[model samples]
Target: MAIAAKHNLELKQYDVTNAFVHASLDREVYMRMPKGYQKPGTILRIKKALYGLRISPLLWQKDLTATLTQLGFQIVPHEPCCMIKDGIIIFYYVDDIILAYGKDQSKKAQEAMDQLKQRYSITGGDDLQWFLGIEVIRDRSKQLIHLSQVAYYEKINRLVDDQTIRHDTPMATSELMPREGLATPSEINRYQRKIGSLLYAAVNTRPDIAFATSRLARFLANPSQEHQQAADRVLLYLSDTKWLTLRLGGGTAMQVASDASFADNTLDRKSSQGY
Candidate 1:
C-alpha cells in the first residue's frame, strides 16, 4: 500500500500452482510405494522438484522467469525478483506479488493479472487490509498509506497485564545502570526471555521501547532487581502507548540512529552503548 500510495499504483496478488513441480531434473531418483504397490522392488523415477530439497524454490523461480520472459515481460534489470511491461511493474517476494501501475491504466493491469491467473492463482486485487502483520490503511484522496501495530500492542498488553502500574517511564532511572553479583540466575533467564520478545517488537514496529528494551537486554546474563523493575516499567509504558503508530510519510526515508553513553552505569561505573 505504501508503494501504491506513493506512486499512484494499483496493487494485485498472485500465487503459483505447484510451484516446485515445474523444475526440470537432471538426476533420477526412486521412492518406496506408499503401502499399495504389488511389487516390493518397484521404483518410481522423479522428474520434478520434490519437497524438502534445498534447491526447489530457486529452481521454481528460474522456471517462472523463463515463462514470464516468453510472455514479453522484461525482468527488472536490477531486481531479479521484479518485472515490468509498458508502465506496469510487479515486485515479487517468493510467491507474494505486488503490482504497481498508473491510475488510468488499471484495466491493463487487470489484464496482466488475468494472464498471470491463467497460469497461477490470483488471490486479491482490492481491499488488502493487512500484510506481514502490518495494518495497512489507504486514503485514496490524500494518497497516503498508514501502517499500525495496534494488534501487536494488544498482544503485549494481554501478555503483561499491569493495568494498575503507573504509566511512567518504561525503565526507572535506578534500573538503567548495572551492578555486579546482583541478579540471580533464574531471574536473569526469565527476564532475558521477556526482554528478547520486546526487542523483536522494538525492531519491527515499537521504536518507543527500544531504549528501555536495549538497557534491560544488557543484563540478560545477570539481571538484577533493577533489571526486573526496568522490564516492568516498559509494560507500564505500553499501557499508554498501545495505539502509537509510525506513519508512512509522502516522501520519508527509513533511517535509524543509535547512541551510547559513557560511564552511564551508576552501579559498576561502566559506559552504556545503544544501537
Candidate 2:
C-alpha cells in the first residue's frame, strides 16, 4: 500500500466467481448426491473442486498460481498469493483480487487483467475502497492511503454493553498480572473471545493497542474480574478512538521502531518486545 500511494498508483479490484469450482480435482473423490439429484444405488463422483471439500482451497491456489505465472506474474518470495510483473503488483486471497499500477503501466496492467478475465469470471474493475474488511482511504493529492477498521471495531465493541463510559488509554497505569483465583469456565470463555477479537485489531490497524492486548492475553486461560475489566477497558478505548487509522505513503523509504518491557513477565521473567 505504501508503494502504491508513494507512486500515486491506481488500484483495481476483481472477484473470481465460484472460484473453487473452477479448479479440477487432482485426486479421485466421491460424494453422496443431493436430495434433488439422488437416484437409487447411485453415488456421485466429484470431478471439480467444491467449496466444502478440504482440498478445494489448495486446488484453487494451484490453478490461480499457474494462471498468474503463465501471464508472466512472478510469485513474491514470501507471499504465494501475491505476484509482481514489472512495477505492477497483483494480490489475491481466495476469490478477491487487487491490481496496482502506475499511470504509465496502466495499459500493461489492464492487459494482464484482461488475460485473467478470459480464464475466470472476473468482476469489479472499480477503484479499491475495501479489502479484507479493512477500508482503504486514499488521498491521491497527498499520495497517501489510510487503513481503517471502524466497522470491525464497532462489531467487537458490543462485547461491552455499556458504551456510556469512555477510556482514554488502552490499559490502566497499574500492571496486569496472572489470575490468582479460580475463574469459572464461562468467564474464561468470555475473555478468550474478547481477546481473540482484539488480536485481529492489534495485528491489523491498532498497533497502539498491541501492548495492552498482549497483557490481557496472559489471563485468557483463567481470567479474574480485574482482567475482564481490563479487557473491557481496551474495547472502550477503541470505541473512543475508533477513527484512528494507519497512514501508508509519502516516500519509498523503510522505517523501523521497537521497544521492550524489561523482565516484565512475573510468570516466566521473560521480556516482551514490540516492533
Candidate 3:
C-alpha cells in the first residue's frame, strides 16, 4: 500500500471465486457420500481440492503460483504469496489478491489481471478498499493511504468498557510476575482471550501496546487478578486512543527501530554456557 500511494499506482482488489476448488487434487481421493446425497453403496471421488480438505490451501497456492509465474511474475524472495514483475506487485492471502502498479505500468497490470481471470473465476477488480479486515482509506490528493482496523478494534475495545474510564498507559509501571496460586481453567482461557485481542491490535495498528501485550502474555499459564487488570488497562488504553490510524506513503524511505530489556525473563536466569 505504501508503494501504491508513493507511486500513485493503480490498486485493484480481486477475489477468486471458489478458489480452492479450482486446484485439482494431486492424488485420487474418495469420500463416503455426504448424508443428504448418500447412496447405500456409493462413494464420491473428489477431483478438485475441497474446502475442508487439509491440503486444499497448499494445492490452491501452488496453482496460483504456477499461473502467476506463467504470466511473467516471479515469487518475491522470502515473501509468501507475493509476486512481482516489471514494477507491478501482486500479493495475496489465500484468495484475496491486490494488484498494484504505477500509472506507467497500467497496461501491464491489466494484461496480468486478464491472464489471471482466464485461469480462475475472478471478481472485484476495483480500487482496493478492504483487505484482511483492515480498511484502506486513500487520499489521492495527498498521495497518502491510511490503514485502519477501527471496525474490528472498536468491537474488541468495547469488551473492556464503554468509555467510562480511559487508561494513560497500556501497562502499569510495576513489573508483572506469574502467580503461584492455582488458576482455574476458565481463568486461563479468559487471560488467553485478552492476550489474543491485544495481540491482534498490537500487530495491526497498535505498536504502542506490543511490549505490554508481550508482558501480559508471560502469565497466560497462571493468571491472577492483577493480570486481568493489566489486560483491562491495555484495552482501556486502546479505547482512549481509538481514532489513531497507521499512515503509509509520503516518504521514500522507512526505518525499523528495536530495543531490548536487560534479561527480563525470570525462568531462564542463567544458561549452561553463559547468561
lDDT of 1 by residue, 110-177 (tens): 88778777765546675556656667777767777776767765665544533555655666655355
lDDT of model 1 at position 265: 69
Q: Candidate 1 regions off by >4 Å? A: 13-87, 161-168, 174-196, 217-236, 251-275
lDDT of candidate 2? 0.89
Q: Rate the local accuracy (lDDT) of all candidates.
A: 0.70, 0.89, 0.85
Q: Scored by Cα lDDT, where does model 1 land?
A: 0.70
Candidate of highest lDDT: 2
Q: What TM-score quantifies how close candidate 1 is to the native fold?
A: 0.66
lDDT for 120 (candidate 2)? 93
Question: Candidate 2 on 15-34: residue-level lDDT in tens?
Answer: 99999999999999999999
RMSD of each: 5.0, 1.8, 3.3
Kindly list the per-residue Cα lDDT of model 3 for residues 79-198, writing each as its tens digit: 878999988999999999999998888898899899889889999989999988889999999899998877876778655623444567777777677787799998888888889998
Least accurate 10 contiguous residues by lDDT in model 1? 156-165
Model 3: ten consecutive residues of lowest lDDT: 266-275
| TM-score attained by model 3 | 0.90
The C-alpha TM-scores of every prediction are: 0.66, 0.93, 0.90
User: Against the true structure, whose TM-score is highest?
Assistant: 2
